[model samples]
Target: MNIIEDLRARDLINQMTDDEGLENHLNESRVTLYCGFDPTADSLHIGHLLPILMLKRFQEAGHRPIALVGGGTGLIGDPSGRNEERQLNEENVVQEWVKNIEDQLSRFIDFTDDQKGAKVVNNYDWLSKMSIIDLLRDVGKHFSVNYMLAKDSVESRIENGISYTEFTYMLLQSLDFLRLNQEEDVSLQIGGSDQWGNITAGLELIRRTSQEGEEVKAYGLTVPLITKADGSKFGKTAGGAIWLDEKKTSPYEFYQFWVNADDRDVVKFLKSFTFLPLEEIDELAKEVEERPEQRVAQRRLAEEMTKMVHGEEALNQAQRITHALFNGDIKELTKEEVEVGFKDVPTFELEESEKGLIDLLVEANISSSKRQAREDISNGAIYINDERQQDLKYFIDENDRIDDAFTIIRRGKKKYFLIKHV
Candidate 1:
């Protein structure tokens, strides 16, 4: 199938300009397209997955994809999706965020010199060089204040007050597309549905700024905003944002995020994110309907997505950790495995000379007090290194260490604690 057809079938195309014409243009040759990602955080959340996946689809379909890192725009913050003005980050902080985001994006798109391979560009390279006077005379004049104010991005923030810096955000974004169209021959811009206004503004800029009848055609496409079936936002848990970086989000937690996908949203998520062919997806859909308790589809989704972002080794470690934790087989795990497995769990450091099991448990917050810790130990609710430790006076001394440095403590059935020798 053609690119547009594939996108539509997968429900990736939320809004687009002239679908037929864009498809015809795309099928002709290796047409260049771009999607801009602003570094709002050090790592991308699952909400950013749709556009990145869309870019992957474009590259697979023989179109060149340019992943634009909005180093310049990130400092200003795009107000498209926010209810109020965003807190602007510092230049140095945004630059660091840009580097982190670029490194993460590189994992997904091929950046080789092949005809349709992806490329990365930073708008700061161009946007930073433009003088204020030149910017106003060359690009700012094309967009009137009335037109800018009418945009939903600005309109929604009227009561809260939008700044001039933010007000010019659309113009800066438009210039990125105009520049890419001129320099890289990029003809399409893709983003989340919230970016529809900014994407269209870029298209309009390209239309008006290009030479007369030059046929510098460009298109805009957006993916639907990911939301929970129960009407909550995606990519968020009670803990916080689900980051692509392993340091920011443990692989186990990331896997759990997908494994816990609502029964209603799993089918749509599979189509939107995974490259599994339609037939295989259809079969999985049937399996989901017939036996959701098996959770075959959910497992596949979690595995595919986790592997894509975190790599095979991390996925394996995550799965192993999950199984080990669930089965109460903590002793079976190696020191390295314990480290990776309990990376997200609460931890405490104890000097071998200073503390025993009771003091350690209370300090780690596993119990309210030393007396409570003693009571739990007597009640058989405490396990050390996967063995029941029922003695209150059983101090974790040097011999109790696994690998001579660490101790694992479990309270009840679900809570875990790690103690390290200083």
Candidate 2:
């Protein structure tokens, strides 16, 4: 199938100016395309995966893709998805974020010296150099107040409010497209569905600004807003955004996020995130219907995405921890792996003198009272390191610790706590 057909099958295409024309153009030539990523944070989250994957998809299809880092535009944040104006980051912070974001992008798109190799361009190169006269005389003339106000990005914020800096963000993005098309011969732009207004605005600027009878053949496409079948936003957890950086969010946590996907959303996520062939995904989908209790589809999706984002070793570590936790053998986790796996679990620090299990429970607030603690031990409802501690007199010494650092406690079947020896 053609690229458009492939994207259609994966449910990646949401809003396109003209898929037929773009498809024909792609069929006839190796068109140059670009997707802009704003470094609002130090790292891209899991939600940023779709468009990066979209760029990767095109690069694999022999198109030269440019990953535009919005070093300039990020200074004034995009008002597309925000209810309020974004507080601008210090230049130094945004510069650091730009480096981090570019490193993340390198993992997905090929940047080798091949003819169709991906390229990274920062809009700050041009946007910072342009004067207000250049901006008004060239770009501002093409955009009228009524037209800009009608766009969803501006219209949604009219009542709540929007600042002049953010209100003019679309023009800045349009400038990026125009600059890239002129300099890099980039003729197409891709982004998330929230970026539809800006993407089309870029297309308009490209058309109107063509110089000396030059014909402009630019296009825009935006991927769907990924929503879970459970009617919640994708890539978010109780802890917050699932970051691509291992330090911000561990590889194990990232893997577990996909592993725990609902059966309903697993197949859809596989199609959107993985480059797996449609046939293989279809087979996995069939397994979801036949033997869902095994969670075959969810396992496959988790493994594929984890490997894609983190690497094979990280995926293996995640699977090992998952199986160990399932079999009640969490003692198998290493010190660092344990830290990554249970970072969010409730934890209590144990003083050297306070090693007795009953007192520790009372102090850690794991038990309401000493009476409750004794009764819990007697009923075999208290566990030390996944081993039931029936002795009310049991004392947890350094010998009871895993790696001399941590000891897991289970109050019951589901509730878990960690004891850290200071």
Task: Give the range of the ten consecutive residues with the poorest summed lDDT in model 1.
Answer: 351-360
Relative to the unseen true structure, what is the C-alpha lDDT of residue 378 in candidate 2, on a scale of 0 to 100?
Answer: 95
**Model 2 deviation from the true structure expressed as Cα RMSD, one decimal place:** 1.5
Residues 40-91 of candidate 1: C-alpha lDDT, one tens digit per residue? 8888988888899889888888778999999999988898978877888999
Best by lDDT: 2
Q: What TM-score, over all chains together, does every model reach?
A: 0.92, 0.97
Error of 1 at 165 (Å): 0.5
Candidate 1 at residue 151, lDDT?
88
For model 1, the stretches where C-alpha displacement exceeds 4 angstroms are 114-116, 353-375, 391-400
Model 1 / residue 334 / CA error / Å? 3.0
C-alpha RMSD (angstroms) for model 1: 2.4
TM-score attained by model 1: 0.92
